[model samples]
Every structure is written in structure tokens, then in C-alpha cells.
Target: MHRPALRTLLGARALARNPARRAMPTASHYHRTSNEASTAMRQPSTNTPRPPSRTGIAARIAHQLLAPCVLALSLGTSMSSHGAGPAAAPERPPAGTDVDETRTVAQRTRAPADCLSVVLEGVTVLLDRSELSRQAHAKPTQWKTEAERMALIEGRRAAALLQAAAPAQGSSPACHPVTQTLDGDDQFVVLAHLERGAAAVLPAGATQPVPSVAIRYLGQRCGPLCGRGSIMVSIPGQPQPFMVTHWWAS
Candidate 1:
């Protein structure tokens, strides 16, 4: 019946008396529970959400086809915006190359004719019959009766020849009956005569006529000194006339 037996009997009596009183867990048990909780925290969780699954073959094929198209579209857009793409250049012929010889010759030939027409037209205006007669009579020189009569007749004839030879509507020929010679390269000397040594020489260009005192004097000198009647006209690109009149007073 000793102390151990008595202690056991007292513990049983307490348990019966306090049914609500529970046994406290040991420190080892608490340590084991803490280890289990730590392991649970360390391990990866399966409850986390997973990524959405892709359409296996169809998605891969679509990506493969669209990748090149997207890359090409982006490259084209960049090139167009920057203006860096190479382009074909227009072809140009070498400098000083003659394209059409025929056309060039035709143009060269046509220019002289046009200049000639201008000369004829200008001379015709200057040598009007009544105007020339008036100018002749107004001069200070006194001519013999026969010479004065001849001068008037020659002036009328010169005027008539110029008017008849000039173009009625358009361009006239380079060698009209009134034109004597066409001379010079850039400028032209136009000479026309109605009587002996009675001539007019004017400088004409493509557009304008220059006044010549020599020619005016020649036109006026027909009263006495003039011996032979001759006309000379010069167009551009021709030699100057050497002898304007065939005869002069001896």
C-alpha cells in the first residue's frame, strides 16, 4: 500500500472530479506540429491558377504564317515613311547630241526666209511712190528737166516693184524681183534700185530695220549722177554686194 499506490488513487479521484480539465500537450508534440506547419509553407501550392492553354497546332501555324506578313508590313511602312527605297531614274541623252539633222537644217533654212520677208516689208514702206517723189523734189539739188523727169519716173517704178514683190498676206521669197542681194551672218543689208545708181541699202534683222543715210542719199541722187539702174538686197548669212550699181557718170 505504499506512496505510489496512494498517489495513483488521488490522480484518478481528481480526473473524476474535474471532467472538463484536459491533459496539456508535451513540448515535443508542439515542436513536431511547428515543423509540419513550416513544411506546408515551404512546399509549392497546387491551388494557384494555371495559365490558359493554347490551341496546339492551329495556333502555331497561324503564328508561322502571320509572322512574315507582319514583318513585311512593318518593313514596307518604314521604308515608305523614310523614303529610302531605291527607284529607277529617267534616261537622259548625252549633251550636244544632235537629235534630228533634217529638222535642224529646215529651221536654219527657214530663218533666212523669215528675215528676208521682214526686210522686204520694211523697204516697201520706205519707198512709197508719192513719198519718194516728195522727198526728191524737196532736195536742194537742181536737176535738168530731163533728169528730173527721169528721177520721178524711176521713183514710181521702184515703189511699184517693191509693192508688187512684197508678200500679200504672208512671208515672201528671199530673191524677189526687187531684192538685189541678202548678206551678213547676224545682220542683213537689203539693197533695192529702180534706176541707174539710184538704190537703197538698209540693214535689216529678224525683227528691226536700221536707218542708213548712205541709202537715203543714194535714193535721192538719181536726178543727175546716177547712170545705171540696179537694186541689191542682202539677207543674213550672205556676202556683201561689191558693186551696187553697174554704171556711174563718167
Candidate 2:
């Protein structure tokens, strides 16, 4: 009776130590389960998705946000870094050639009307009103040199065109003059041609001896900056003169 009682106590203790063994699992069963759990922890399932790294996320963001032009510039930079040359852009006009660069333009005048407007053959010109009036009625200036005499003669002729035309307003789209700085001031000059010519309009206070073509001088003649300029116009027998803008280095 005593031995049986002792055996029953030991069995109760063994049951208390392993209460999870309700099915009375064998050693092999435990081994198989341990191996499966370790393997599952070591290797994730193939179908499970992984989170992206920091670098990969940044690259995707940049690809979405960058523009095509930015990408092209980046490509150019990259090529240059790899000892490849980049294409050069023009900085200034080529020398020795009178470039018909009508594209190069100064500031738009907003129709300020700094100079007086004069029209001959329907083409308009801007000039100093006082200077034109003085040149129109002035006596012969002393001929210091041939160039000086020619300059005075041209000024008189230009003043005549101003005197012949009445008070008028005109605008030119082709007057894309270049701006140059001299004596702390900016200067620009332009020339326009008339498509057709009309008989001289002899209004009040007109200048005499109108010619077929007239050359006007704005600044001092022959300057890198706009010190002076001369332009010649060929007139036609038509009634109305339409201005045609021509751009040249002045």
C-alpha cells in the first residue's frame, strides 16, 4: 500500500511538470516541430514582400519628379565628367561680317517720344527738333576738312526732310537697334526704307532742294558705339510710302 501511494505521488509531479503534453507526444514529434520552427525563422516565405531600402526609395522619387530637360542636362554633365566634351554656345557675334542680326534688340521704348517724328514718303524718322530747325536755315559752316563739309551737308539734307513733313507720329517694328554705352549714356540708331515714294509735300516752313534719296546722320559719323550713322533711301513714283525696316551695325 505504501509503495503504490509513493508511485501515485511521482506520477502527479511528472504530469504537473509537463502539462502541455496532453497528447503524449514522442521524441521524434518534438524534433520535427523544432526543426520546422527554426527553418521558418531562418528563411522567409518567397511570396512575402520586402520593404525598399533608403537609396531605392530616393531614386524612385527623383525619377518621378525630374523633368526631361533636367535629365538631359544631367546627362550632359555626366558625359563631361567622363572626359567627353559638351557643345559650346555662342557668346558674341562673329567679327568682320556685317551680321544681319535683326534678332539682337535693345529695350522697347514704350513710345516715350524722346525725339521729334518726321515723315517723308510716309516713312517716319525721329530727330532733335531744335537741331533740325537750326540746320535747315543755317549759313555755311567753315570747311575744316572734306569729312566735316560732308557731315554738315548731310545734316542739312536730313533737316530738310524733317522740315517738309508736318507734325506726325510713326512706329517701326524693324527698328531693332543695338545699345552701346558712351560718355556715360546709352545710344541706339536705326534706318528704315520706304517701299514707294511720293511727290514732296510742300507744307508751311519747308526746306528747299529735296533730292531723290536722302542720307541722315544721327550721331557723329563712324563710331563703334552709336556716335553717328548714315542711311540712304531710294524712292519710287508711287503715292504712299510704306516703311521697310533694315538693321545694320551702327
TM-score of each: 0.23, 0.24
lDDT of each: 0.34, 0.36
Q: Which ranges in model 2 have alpha carbons more than 4 Å from their true place?
A: 1-115, 118-126, 134-142, 167-250
Q: State each candidate's clash count.
A: 15, 3
Candidate 2 lDDT tens digits, 132-249? 3454455256668744454455345545454444444353312211122111001111221111111222222433213343322121223222221112332334333333322122
- What candidate 1 gets wrong by more than 4 Å, as runs, is 1-144, 170-205, 211-239
Clashing pairs in 2: 219-228, 220-227, 220-228
On TM-score, the candidate that comes out on top is 2
